[model samples]
Target: MDTIIIEGGSTRLKGQVTIEGAKNAVLPLLAATILPQEGKTLLRNVPILSDVFTMNNVVKGLNIALEFNQEKKEILVDATGDILDEAPYEYVSQMRASIVVLGPILARQGHAKVSMPGGCSIGSRPIDLHLKGLELMGAKISQVGGDITATAKKLKGANIYMDFPSVGATQNLMMAATLADGVTVIENAAREPEIVDLAVLLNKMGADVKGAGTETLIITGVERLHGAEHDVVQDRIEAGTFMIAAAMTSGDVLIKDAIWEHNRPLLAKLTEMGVEATEEADGIRIKSDLTKLKPVTVKTLPHPGFPTDMQAQFTALMAVVNGESTMIETVFENRFQHLEEMRRMGLHSEILRDTAIIHGGQDLQGAPVMSTDLRASAALILTGMVAKGQTKVTKLNHLDRGYYQFHEKLKALGAKIERVSEVEHV
Candidate 1:
């Protein structure tokens, strides 16, 4: 087991840190690579994360010729050859995002058999919306032996309305509809920037998609799609985590090339907590001087609101701020598991139905903790940076799924952190 050991107290993180490409965006973009029948797709600025390796292996499992160059952060995919109809249980079982490939495989091969997906234990993330939308688009869905299969001789478009604006469902349906026989309209669709980025790539690949970044998406089917080039969008969740780190330490740091618009909600809340964030031509710079931070209430929602991904990190911030703070998690039911680990580090909190009421201003002492999920891993490390003694955070497999060189980046910013194996740490 790997653990990140942090020596806390009187440490202020400073200096500029570069943000990585969005892990959420790159997975679906890799799935879209299967849709192109000819030419090679070039994706630039791909993040080097464990999940990327899993998704890349998933694409390679489909018989597509793929090359990932980590030095240049680029991926060249030659999907001009024949594609396989099935994504095996070994790959899909490791990452839930691999299920997005089911849509493109069906669009290209007219049949897709994928194993039941698995991921973090944050909550129940059902694929009912994905299956229902595909059924609306004239795809027959069935389950057998832990695999969900979809078959469509020739898919035809229809007006599909989603009960919830699920990002994965929207991406899967958009890719599936891109090669259908007619126009597909998705109402109540996800309006994330990653969705708009996918729409840009699909259009470049001869797809006619409109109204992206809105509730309704109109995609007209094309005979076939060709490979295209695109750059992955910056990750707002990573930027927000570092922003919170800078503010909590009362340090001055700049997040290079971070988009202010993408992190507007977090920036607004940071300002309310008495932190100064300025938008510059280079990137966003955050500065803080308060000895004790102000408490604030937070509610996680879909994009354009406070992101559910950042809720755990902000909760870590709330634990140290003065007065009482409330965190309401409306996205994932079991996301508050990190709070239990935080209790070992001397955090005071009470969990209600979907809300956590944190009584701040308590002295946090460093202790052994475990990461509950991907985002929770970062949150625990952040808490360790301000604790009184040494904090050891384990279950780093979750951290590697999303963040790239996280501890190295923090160390460069003056964080007294080191990653070592369990035996070495002991």
Candidate 2:
């Protein structure tokens, strides 16, 4: 087991951090590469996180040959020949994004056998929306044992309106609809920048997709899609995490390679809380004054809204604020699992239904805490930064799945943190 130990420094952190590519965006975009017929698809600015490696393994399991340059951080996915259509349970159980292969496989091969995916214990992220949308698009889907088998001799596009604009479902259906016959329209689609990023790649691959970054998406079926090179969009989650970290430590940090437009909601909230934020052409700069920290209300929503992934990190920021703040998590039921661990770190938080009421102003004294999920691990580390005593965060593997070089980046920001293999017996 890996653990992160943080010694309270009391010093304000000040530095610059380069935001990595969006993990949520990159995974699905990688899965979409399965649709390309010829030429090696080059993806640059990819984040080297555990989840990315897991997705890469899943892609490899499908027998799609890939050449990755670790130093350059580029992956060349060559999906030329007859690719494997089955995504075994072994790979899918590791990450939910593995289910994304269902659409691309069905689109290109006319059949797919994929395992139901499993990911963070945050909540029940059902794939019904994905299956239902594919069913609407003329795919015959069935469950055999623990796997989902979908077959579409020839997919004909139709209207797919989701009850909620699920990002996973939107990406799946968009890829599946690419090779579909006729026109496919997705109503109430996710407006996340990742969706647009995938659309941009698909268009470059010869698919006609329009109305991205909006509620409605229209895709015209193309017979074949050729491979194209594309650079992934910068991760807004990474940028938001750095922003919250800076705020928690009352630091000044510049996040380069971040898209300011993609982080409007978080930026707005951070600005409201008295965090000095400036948007530049390249990225955004965030500086926090400990004296001005204040409580604020945040409700998690879908794309173009407050992301659920950032909830835990923001909660840590609110822990040291001057007043009470409310965080409503509308995306996942178990997202507040971090609050229990936060309490162990001297945070005053109460969970009522989906809302967490945080009574701030307490000088957090760090204690041993366990990470429950990816974002939760980040929140714990952020809490450790401002806490008064030594903090040990166990189960750091979850943190590795998302953030690249967690402690290294914090160390560069002058944080007193270290990743040690030795575990302290409580």
Candidate 3:
């Protein structure tokens, strides 16, 4: 087992850190590779993370020849040859994002059978919206055993509406609508920047998709799609995590290439806590040397709202603030599992249903904590930045699923951290 060991105390994070491409965008783009019938798709700015590897393997398992050049940070996918229809449990079970490939597979091969996917146990992320959207587009879907099989003689477009603006459902349905006949309109679609990134790639691949960064999406079906080159967007969640860490420690850090627009809500929240975030020519520069931070209320919502992903990190910030803060998580249930772990470190917080009342002004002493999910792992590490004594974070595999070189980056910013490996038992 591997753990991130942190010697926590007052530390200043000063320097510029460049972020990798967005993990949320690249996974769906990797799935989008299956839509192209010929030519090679070149993806630029791909993040070097464990989940990306898992999704790449899932793509390759379907007979798509993939070559990843780490130094170049590019993935060359040639899904031009004979494609397979089944995505086995071996690969799909490792990451829930693999469910995305099912839509692309059915769009290209006309039939697909994929094993149920498994990922972070944050909440129940059902694919019913995806299935329902496909069914509206004339695809017959059914659940047999542990697999979902979808088939259509020829998929035709239709008008569909989502109860919630789910990022995964929008990506899957949008990709599936590429080779579909006629036109497909998705109402209440996800307006995340990653969705816009996918739309850019799909359009480059010869699919007519519009209104990507808006509430509605219009995709006109094409006979077939060809490979294209695209650049992935920056990881807003990863950057936001670093931004919060900087603010929590009252440090100065310049996050390079971080899109200010994508992280407006987080920056606004930081500003409310008396943190100074200045938009520079290259990126956003954050400075925080406050003796005390003001408490602020946060409500997690879809894009253009405070993101659910940043809730955990923000809660850590509220732990040592001037007063009590309230946080309501509207996106995922059971996300408060990390709060129980926080209590072990001497933080006080009350959880009622989906809302948490965090009492600040408590001195923190480090303790061993286990990560519950990918974002929870980040939350724990952020808390460790200001905690007294040594903090050891286990279940690093969760952290690795998203952020690339997380410890190395923090270390570069002058944090006392290390990656330790335990002896293997035979």
In angstroms, how far off is 212's CA in candidate 3?
0.4
Q: In candidate 3, how many clashes are counted? A: 0
Off by over 4 Å in 3: 424-426
> Which candidate comes out best when scored by lDDT?
1
Query: Residue-pair clashes per candidate, as listed?
Result: 0, 0, 0
The reply for model 2, stretches above 4 Å from the true place, is 423-426
Per-model TM against the reference: 0.99, 0.98, 0.98
What does the lDDT come to for candidate 2? 0.90
- Model 2 lDDT at residue 318: 90
lDDT accuracy of residue 114 in candidate 2: 92
Q: Between which residue pairs do clashes occur in model 2? A: none
Taking the tens digit of each residue's C-alpha lDDT, what string does model 1 give over 1-426? 899999997778899999999998999999999999889999999999999999999999998999999999999999998779999778899998998999999999999999999999999999999999999989999999999999999889989999989999999999999999899999999988889989999999999999999999999999999999999999988999999999888889999999998899999999998899999998999998746568999998888779999999999888888889999999889999999999999999999989999998799999999999999999999999999999999999999999999999999999999999878857
**Candidate 1, after superposition: displacement of residue 1 in Å?**
2.2
- For 234-332, candidate 2 gives per-residue lDDT tens digits of 888988999899888889888886778888999999999999999877678899997887789999999778989899999988988989999999999
Compared with the true structure, model 2 gives a TM-score of 0.98
Cα distance off (Å), candidate 1, residue 86: 0.1
